[model samples]
Target: MPSQEALSAQVGAVYTTSTGAPVAEPYAAQRVGLTGPLLLQDFHHIDLLAHFDRERIPERVVHAKGSGAHGVIKVTHDITDLTVASLFSKVGNEAPLTIRFSTVGGESGSADTARDPRGFAIKIKTDEGNLDWVFNNTPVFFIRDPAKFPHFIHTQKRDPQTHLKDADMFWDYLSQNPESIHQVMILFSDRGTPDGYYMHGYSGHTFKFVNKDGKFHYVQIHLRREGGAKSLDNDTAQRLAGENPDYATEQLFTEIEAGKFPTWNVFVQTMTAEQAESFRYNILDLTKVWPHKEFPLRPVGQIILNKNVQNYFAEIEQAAFSPSHLVPGIEPSADPVLQSRLFSYPDTHRHRLGVNYGQLPVNAPLAPVSNFQRDGAMAFNNQGFRPNYQSSLAPLQYKRKAYEDVKHEIWLGDANVDLSYVTELDFEQPRALYEKVFSDTDREHLIYNLSVHLGNVKSPIVKARQLSVFAAVSKDLGDRLAKAINHPSVEPLAVKPATEAIRYKLKAA
Candidate 1:
């Protein structure tokens, strides 16, 4: 290998500090003598050491490990009737996008093939502003209530005492919270370990698309792989986890690098407010999914990941996404989880990235940004000489859209908040999934997967509670799970009491 000087000379490139100060002796540090202590005046050496020490930013509390790529979202279908967002103003409208695929409940060094939901976050640079769709590989989540979020995440993480993944701790929380059975079933299935990152992505949260007329439709977004979705069996996933932990990340990068761009067809299942009222399950329920039969998927467009990130740290790692990053016409629903996320996502970004995280190139919107925010740790764009408050002397022009002034929906009910109770309705979908959706082989795999993890749980009480929850979903599923785990018998349990009892009911006025 050529020396630094030789390489620089051959390339005719000057070596400089971050501030562009040319450095002649790039390799040597100034010192008192050949073997003496380093001089404090050696700013270059000190700067290098200081920068190296602060090189790492705070990793995300969740979805710490991820892979990302540059892409484009091409609007193939006209949805102007549905949403007034300019991202889909006309057919063939294409917007540049950045997508991050990640494993939830994992540290930065964790294996990519872990049996965890993949965070499918996309930042679409639209003409109006940046619209972020922070989705997941699965259509449903473990819990619907936002209050249970931290507790549920804690269960997924290491136990406080042991500082290790504790099966007893994991199942104890899930067993007590039976509403999680739906997502739990999906988690333990073959779908848990996806075939690399080539899996379907779902919004999970129901949103709204408001038109110019102020009419709105509740929507659920889905991203289906162009070919089809694929999954790996437990053995294969485990093998890859040990052999090559970065298998999924490598596959995505190499595929894009080879010019074999993976495409996902976007679709939405929409329902009117009137329809939502009569729907079997609450639209706000995160654990439940709208039946495709009732609300069919309408084609939207295609997302083609054509380019790979040149620098992971700068381009991908620094990129921030939030469910609240909505443009006009696209609005969040009343789902408690989604509602909570609107605040939490940006708050987490502020804490993890910085107060001025939005100023980062990857996160900054395509549209010109004019805001009152100024002066933080890293305020790249401080809007110099501009007043931070509204002023008649130099008034900022604000373009008000149709939806901006429209009062689309109104809530006239008493404020009532509590953890959602587990009812028979909670188990209906999971039962259907096991009985109707899963093939014989899929069922076998599901049973095996559940057995592998749940079997490790040493507490018989926790194991029995979870089995009962399964039995409630389906007697066959519960029996199979029990037999696989070598348990004696399985009995369906009544609806378990939630962490907190319903304190108040929503009474319509």
Candidate 2:
């Protein structure tokens, strides 16, 4: 292992300014004879104070609390037939990677054991470029509509006037948008508070893997912890949240530093466009999952976290990952949330990490970048001496398409949008998840967890509405939740079921 001061060029160094001008003293400011007002001529003192005042960047609006580590991803299977992504070019090919695990809807200081969906974001520095899989720990999410995301996130945060985490705000959103029920069930389950960063991961939205033959398959990415998903009981998670707020974050870094590296296996479930068209659920819906029975998980690679980051602020905090960071042969689906993220993520990075964020060491691509873009804040490399526009004298090179004549997806419909309303089918998967997927103990604990959280909600109408949503999933679950909270159930408002999408398409036919 390297020494803690390995990065330092000199064992004992003189203090320096931001631009490296040697500083004689930084402890005491240059004042008028040490008793009068400070001298404005002292550049080093002024610079130190100014930089300290603006040291921290704005926190991420979501997934604010996070832990990160460096790792390697080794391809374990030949998936060239599925996609031309260079990382999967051959079995045993290894690529350097960095992963950042975060809690959704929490501030930077929030507890690691908080009951929230974890963000499992990995950036692979491949020969082609950086391929980032910014995924979640759950197979599904709360809402499908992209426009509703801000509104949904607002509910997760504290109330505006009260400045407190409002249960009414949280439960009301879930109750109204029952599409969130599937994820709500998972969020309330043991999986919500994972034991550590090595737990399972999933791309809730469908994506595309296009092959050299111009064939494309809708894909769902998954990552299973080397041993399997490990989770904490609600009681334990809550207890640890108070006792050790940074439990998971601290553990991951400590384990890596101690050489007890954790690992996870990457897998994907692929469905052809035809299969997706005939599938039970809308393939683009983020709130549903493709049944593993029909589309089984195919092993792709292994991700091993073997190193801890040296500087949390420089490497981890400044690091950025986005689903839009595709190398090649991969593309975003028509999933509304994912399509929206392709824009929103880079937008946030610009605001948070500046327009030249990609030039940051942690976010920069390993592959050579040749673009007309130049000049921005923190412009580390301005493509020196190159024309910013196309010129015959120095024509920019372009890569040929690996595949041609592929069927391009064309999205067509009315400009007006409606929320993908709830249906009997909408509740079907969560019902199976509650009955078949979960063990009896898991079900009991889930009920208890939901009961405790929902019980805190002071509004009777909100509780009643949530119970109705649960009832739609299963009367047993609804009854169990109501009994646990000692509350009466109310009927949920009827919305068009998922079959409605098919019905509308059929009627158009």
Candidate closest to the true structure, highest TM-score: 2
lDDT of 1 by residue, 129-149 (tens): 999999999999988778888
Pick out the ten consecutive residues of candidate 1 with the lowest summed lDDT. 500-509
lDDT tens digits by residue: candidate 2, 1-509: 34376657556877789999887777878888859999999888888889899998999999999999999999999999999988888899998998999999889999999999999999999999999999999999988888889999999998999999999999998888888989999999998889977589999888889899989988999998987888999999989989999999889988887888899988999998777656777777788898888999999989999988877898889998999999678888877788899999999999999999999999988998998999978898899998899989999988976976354344211211355556677788898999999999999999999987999999888899999988888888988889899886555556565556643555357
RMSD of each: 3.6, 2.2
The runs of at least 3 residues in candidate 1 whose Cα sits more than 4 Å from the true structure, single-residue gaps closed, are: 1-10, 404-418, 496-509
The C-alpha lDDT values of all candidates are 0.87, 0.86
